[model samples]
Target: MASVSNPILVTGEPYTPGLTREAVCETYGVLVDEIAKLGSAENPLGPSPKALIAIAAAMGLTEQYPSWTAEPLRKAIAARYDVAPDEVVCGTGETEVISFIIRAYAGVGDKILMYRPCFPIYHLFAENEGRVPVYVDMGREMDFRVDAYVEALKSEPIRIAFLTNPHSPSGKLMAEADIRRICEAAGDALVVMDEAYIHFTETEGSLHLVKEFPNLIVLRTFSKAFGLAGLRAGFGIAAPEIIRPLWNIKPTWNMGHMQMAGAAAALTDHEHIRRTVDLIVEMRGYIAQRMSGLTAFRMVPGSRSNFFLIEVMDDRLDSTIVFEKLLERGVIIKDGSVSFRGLDKRFLRSDVGSKVNMDRLADALAAIEQSL
Candidate 1:
């Protein structure tokens, strides 16, 4: 066979490293139907019952196109925060909105700023959109450091900045004051805050900040707390003029009718949000405490979110090995090297699942320790 490579293959084979169903179940020599199955690692609670009901009601509307403006959902979201509907726009997912924001504001040779160890989608969108992504280090000891970010902005010519409040992998929440400082430094640049994990944090408030900073755009998802990942619905909040440009670039009726209806229902179910957030908080404490006692790993301090990054001491074993080992035993985790630089082979990020699945993961990790 002839050897051929695509221009995008800067790194070998994109490296999915994910396990197949057969492989996942086979590793422990068990049937696919019976494996403990924590590797897929979505919300263990599944879709909200209210969302399901709404989706069911919208079934007949499948004959019709989704609402282009998503007017009803926008109004619902606005009412939740007492904002004007003009300030909101919905998308297929938060990732799609992020790409739209970057594309709408900047172009070839333009620059976008984001911190290191961020969601990989930001860099991917920037690179493909023919723009430069200027990355700032998130600081070694702390997940978010205002001084370093200010320094980066001081030196870089940034047209836009994407920040994840209650940042992923690290699962560290940023303070309101620090956010204001960042907004101040960006000068004329638009700040895109990815609050995908906002529901998981209690102390930080983002909706209030948008009213103060016209440059601020907040991206939120129903995928996490509302359990609507499968429906692919997320929305962005910004000044109407800022969001207006996006409609020109984005697909009209991109979100399905079912997803729009479901999202609106999810909003009305405030009790569900409260209960889900409370559960995550309790589980986070349990996991953090347990991980703290594990002498084999080092975790980031003061995590106030649903996921946490860990550094494994055994340098010989790569994150892939750790991930695959856990998968075999039915526990799945995110590998951090996808977004960050200088991550040792031992680094990995685990999401908080249901208590039952979490217990299985803990036992699996405990057993894997003996093998390692």
Candidate 2:
């Protein structure tokens, strides 16, 4: 038989998502209602009311194809960001947009630049496309080393560079000045700013940087703050010149009726967004305070996003031990050894959850520490 699969995909490191509530419940024999699902950086408040209404209204149209370009969503995003609609490209999720950019702008064996521990999709998508991913080590504690990225951008003939602000696992938000410095250094390379968690922070974000840099693309998603992770709605903003190719190459009717409807409606639901941000901020603080009293682990500082990391300081426990113990206690979180590259057995990642959920996690950790 002829080779059935592409070797790159057959051998590639597949993306591993956080465990779902059902899986945890099944494995741990815990009731669904008792599980504290802090593994995924999901909005604990749930979907926006306006978005729920819009999605319900659009459900009947599922039999028909959606707008060829998800026009309403594009328009909504454009209007909110003060950009031309033509400059926006919608996708199933920011992951799809990342894939599209790689397929459209990069070719086989081309170079892609990214930080050592980044949103895994950047490296995974590049590898799948047969592009070479060149990694720049982040500063200690996952800080964005702007000078290192600038040096890499100036030295390499890179086709694209991926930067995740309020970075995953660590949640450190990069300053605008550093971002501008990297953008300036990118000569012919397209710089993709993945701001999936931007809403959790107070910074205004780098959407305006797109207007200043022709090679810049700003990606945002409804998955995080808008509470539409299941809806899978995301879009990218760039100069029309850069967006034209992405739009041209994207799948026709990429977003379904409900996805587009929910996302567009969610964009205007400012109150829901505010509540989500506030909840994350408040719960994160609560969790931080709770973790501070524990001797088994310490919460990594500098997190401005919804999720933060916990580093195991006690010799008797590692991330794997804490992870399994938390699972036994019906608290699900991402074990850094499995979820992220460049991290080890000492770290685990948890997203902000409801007060009750945080209390469950805190109580579980306290129990574990007392046992130790």
Candidate 3:
């Protein structure tokens, strides 16, 4: 047997730098009565009340193992997306399902294709599973060119293609034409569309495309709009043929009883999803508008998504420096420099938080500049 490296090692350091409790409270400035967390990309809005109720109800059933197939969640996902129950597979979260898909579909000598400065986990998992990950460049210039993706696929034996529509970090939305084109070009390869941020976008998602393409797998998570990251529940929608293998690859009774119940309840909470998405969109607009007025940083074009990137030209303050400075001031944002080697030290990424929280970030950055 040949020795192989673990793919999990490829991940960046949790993306959350260390922070003191006092520092966090100072930056967010939340009273004990109010909740304030702006670090993670999670929805600022809390979990749905329905999800809360379900989790409470599920507490009594904790002793039992979850259904072997997570049938209830699978059914709910299928109904929500207008797909057959068998066409859905519930996992601990979309990331776990992504791992299962990549590990099951490809291995040594196989290759995977995805864009650079993406979800990071895709690259991490590819390396762990002994697969080659080809990254296509994306940035302020070409709007994460789909043509490059097509060209890459044309030349590569791409076993799988992982795409984050309205991509993370850059928040660049892909045109419908591009998605259809990629689907057509992929041939037998499995196309995994990570739509974790889709709930924040106005554009329609590619979930429905599963009816037409067996190779298309849409990964959805409640972590964002539904505000259930803590629960760790997500699902995959695809043709029943594709979903079956994913189901086999998933851990037995993977999603706990509480998570399933919470996710199922969240699926029915239209008001929560709607209100949360509205808040994110509003905050995103606010960030874009504020950044537009500033000359110090290069602001990437905003999409209807919940995140964006800012490029700081000041060589003295790399994202890591800014990250540490923000930590001292009680704020936290992802450092794009580590994951995006193509990006200079000045690039840092932040997600849409509440207006107050975002304002604090803007003020902090301005203060940091003035101090420099």
Best by lDDT: 2
Q: How does model 2 score by TM-score?
A: 0.97
Off by over 4 Å in 2: 2-5
Residue 110 displacement in candidate 2 (angstroms):
1.0
Model 2 weakest lDDT span, ten residues long: 1-10
List, residue by residue over 1-372, the lDDT tens digit for candidate 2: 576345888888999998888998899999989999998888899999999999999999978988888888889998998999999999999989999999998899999999977778898889887899999987767788888889888888999999999888799999888998888898789999999999888888999989899999999999999999988989999998998888889887788999988999999999999998988898889999999999888899989999998999999999999999999999999999988888889989988889999999889989999998
Please report the TM-score between candidate 1 and the true structure.
0.91
- Candidate 1, superposed: residue stretches over 4 Å from native: 1-23, 26-41, 338-342
lDDT by residue for model 1 over 54-134, one digit each (tens)?
Answer: 999999988887668888788888988788999998898787899789889987779888788777778776876668888
**C-alpha lDDT (0 to 100) for residue 98 of candidate 3:** 91
Stretches of model 3 off by over 4 angstroms after superposition: 1-37, 339-341
TM-score of each: 0.91, 0.97, 0.91
RMSD of 2: 1.2
Flag the better candidate by lDDT, 2 or 3.
Answer: 2
Error of 2 at 236 (Å): 0.2
- Residue 40, candidate 1: how far off, in angstroms? 6.5
